[model samples]
Target: MKKYFLLVLLLAGSHVMVAQTKKNGVYTPDNGNGTFTNPLMWGDWPDPDIIRVDDYFYFVSTSMHYVPGSPVARSKDLVNWEMLSYAVPRYDEDPRYDMKGGNAYLKGSWANTIRYNNGTFYVGFCTPNTSRTEPGHFSICTAKDPKGPWKRTIFKEYMYDPGLFFDDDGKVYVAHGQERLFITELNADALSVKTPQKEVYNNPAFPYLEGSHMYKVNGKYYMMGSTGGTTGRQICLRSDNIYGPYEAKEVINDDHTYPGNGLHQGGMVQLKNGSWWFIIMQDRGPIGRVPNLEPVTWVDGWPMLGDKGKGVETFKKPDVGKTHPNVVPATSDEFNTAKLGLQWQWNHNPDDQKWSLTERKGYMRLKAGKAAKLSEARNTLTQRVQGPFSAGTVEIDVTGLKDGNVAGFGVFQFPYAFVAVQQKSGQKSIIMVNADSTVTTIPFKGNKLWIKASVTHIGYTASFDYSTDGKNFQKIGNMLNMALGLDWTANRFALFNYSTTADGVSGYADFNWFKLKDSL
Candidate 1:
């Protein structure tokens, strides 16, 4: 009895320790006394566009191929931010509903969500549909509120990663498309181009790069963006005029001591003190594409990033700006709320009625649809992988079992991925590991059970385990490399589920919190 009691005590103690740990997610704004870290918004907040509206600051980012598109956020000091909502709701409304857009474009919306003239919010976006024997198109949207009863205006196709800049002279020009900086004039309502369009800056040619933000500061126009790619490096450039003579200057890139990546995407905001700072996105390759904060300086009106001496990184708020303290939210969720959180997104366009909560059921029911293959399912729900250099376990309780049905969690690295857990067959369930639709069964006792998958980037292993009680885990197989996802390589670690049956799995998954831990 003493031994058993001791075991209970040990278990209780471990749970407490887990609760006390720093709940991992994005790093919030520091109090200005200390330096901040990279990935300010960790998982997949790509092509960020931010605006300083008085004392309050609002930001938005692209959520490509991930549903519930156009992530909206608000912050006071430009540090900590709360997710607002999908800038544009309902994927079916998207012109490209079926895989017609392909994985290249199905990714939720990308870039520029901000309020434009006359009390309406505007967002310039890119739709890179690779499936079609065509390039891509750019569109603009308008909303009364940031939370949005948003509407999109169809226009002639132009560029990707489009950014709308309203100059002081009352002229609205769009600096757009990826690979190069293309520009065109938009009507006063900020919709389509009225003037002949021109490629103001070609990024691939010399220096103008990705995630370009064109701003007017002190009567001078500055264009800062990610030059290389989020992983390789980044740089900022500026010009005295908006039209021409734009020069590229190095910001943060291969020159830094902590030069971890070259490609970067995000926005730059000026503080009340008139100092400059930047937040950019980067792909850790393993963690998925995430955000990072870097302090920048304007020497001779040119932004200097990283360490001028060694060109590395920073935590100090920097003399350039004042610091503000704030908190976003804890990541690990208990699923006790009625509304789904923004941290989660669907694979592509989704069906609204397909997923539901009856309140009394206390679980989300995803009915099977015409989606026999993941490629067919319009909505393959996925959430950003929220970890960095860490070890974590995904625990889920599934009640339904079907041959064509699958529900579990695994690290998502894209095109080639795996789901290591139970597959439902009406009422019976079996433990199995799914990689790229291929299943390897690890026979279990019943249909109702708990599944735990532990991921280790160290050994490049993703193991499957099951437990009646959340302890004494039994390994199902050797490590699974996540890079082998379904269609393309995923940028972040994510949790996903899909069922292709006629009735779908007539059950629910009790998705518990992920006990997140980092590898020191």
Candidate 2:
């Protein structure tokens, strides 16, 4: 009878633990009450542009060099968001996007703008010129639905950091450029330029002014942008005309939330309840720039961000007429579906024929691609590394690995490190490749293994471990110092299978599943 009573208590305790786990994710912005935290998301969601279409809010962010570029997300309360679609499904602008002879690392998309007009959705972004023969062009993708079948139009002119706006007069204009702002009128279709670019506002006071978001409020034209790059402040310009004789003010310049990294470079939206809110980005070191939600107060006909121009650490949720369940972007993947989860993207353009989910049911089969290093390897699947702390674990079957093939998981950036299983000269071994190009190896005859990477924002460090039995993991490498290098992107978790030899394409790696947790 005592044992029966103890079993009941154990079952009750297990249920409570499961409930708690769901309530608090690895890094949820929702505090689970009436209030929430500053960063709406604790991951690399930089250069955010938001818009409101009736009751729903839509957002788009930069996805440079990653296939399915410019991720778009949707939210009801502007706090909990879900991945909707990618603005650019693939890059056909240049051969470099496919890593053919060269690679487009930091040149694909930047500061994308999303707008809804007359039952149509438009997404605009610019790609920098990769070569003399392949010039960069401004792209406008239009869709009847935000989730898309988007049709794209590429313009000859490259408009840096474009802000697409539709005026009441049934005309279109694009506000673009850096330091010196320019305005260019577009044709009614908004796919071609109607006029040559003309400088509108150029002030030395606003150094490095970019990321333009144009809007009209209360019969006044407002141009919102950021200055001083990553450690910058948000600025707003007001004028009576779209082509402005404008007056500027520094709206937000706070670093209390993330000291030395100010909140800047994002758009704002007005809720149905008549409350204004600013969704901005904060440079949070190696984990990448994170998005923050700040309240906007109008003073003297000017929009002031946060509490009197300061960032708020905690505040009441936006009154979207109702409360919303705490939700976040999906992280764990079972690989049981025919299509890859929206959370995953390729490092660059993937060779579709090399990777398959149908070839091996209940698993993702990544055929080996010939590459000397991970950066040049095709079909390297990647996803954002969640912060302030998170761990990613994966189970892989290495039985099909051939000589010169290396398949495993690691965090990817300019400087990347991973714990992979390498088969060389008929010998299979576990190896740790550090950011500095040093390697550590140990013999392992196991056909299946589990690898894990744990990241902590406190020290901005990542450590790797591997296990043959999945339950017991042993450390493999020294702590990797996650650095913000040339990529202009936050470090991402990458899954890759590449080979050093020419005949390695015949080998493959099968990934069973990927799991993520708040702790190691």
Candidate achieving the largest lDDT: 2
For candidate 2, the per-residue lDDT at 507 reads 92
Candidate 2 total steric clashes: 0
Which residue runs does candidate 2 get wrong by more than 4 Å?
A: 1-24, 130-135
Query: In order, what is each prediction's RMSD in angstroms?
Result: 6.8, 6.0
**What do the candidate models score in CA lDDT, each in turn?**
0.57, 0.86
Best by TM-score: 2
lDDT of 2 by residue, 393-497 (tens): 999999899898999999998788999999999899999998737478899998999999998776788999999999999998788889877556999998999
- Which digits, one per residue and each the tens of the lDDT, describe model 1 over residues 180-280? 67677877777777886676666564443666777787888877666655444565557777776677766666422223455466677777777776766
Candidate 2 clashing pairs, residues 3+ apart or interchain: none
lDDT of 1: 0.57
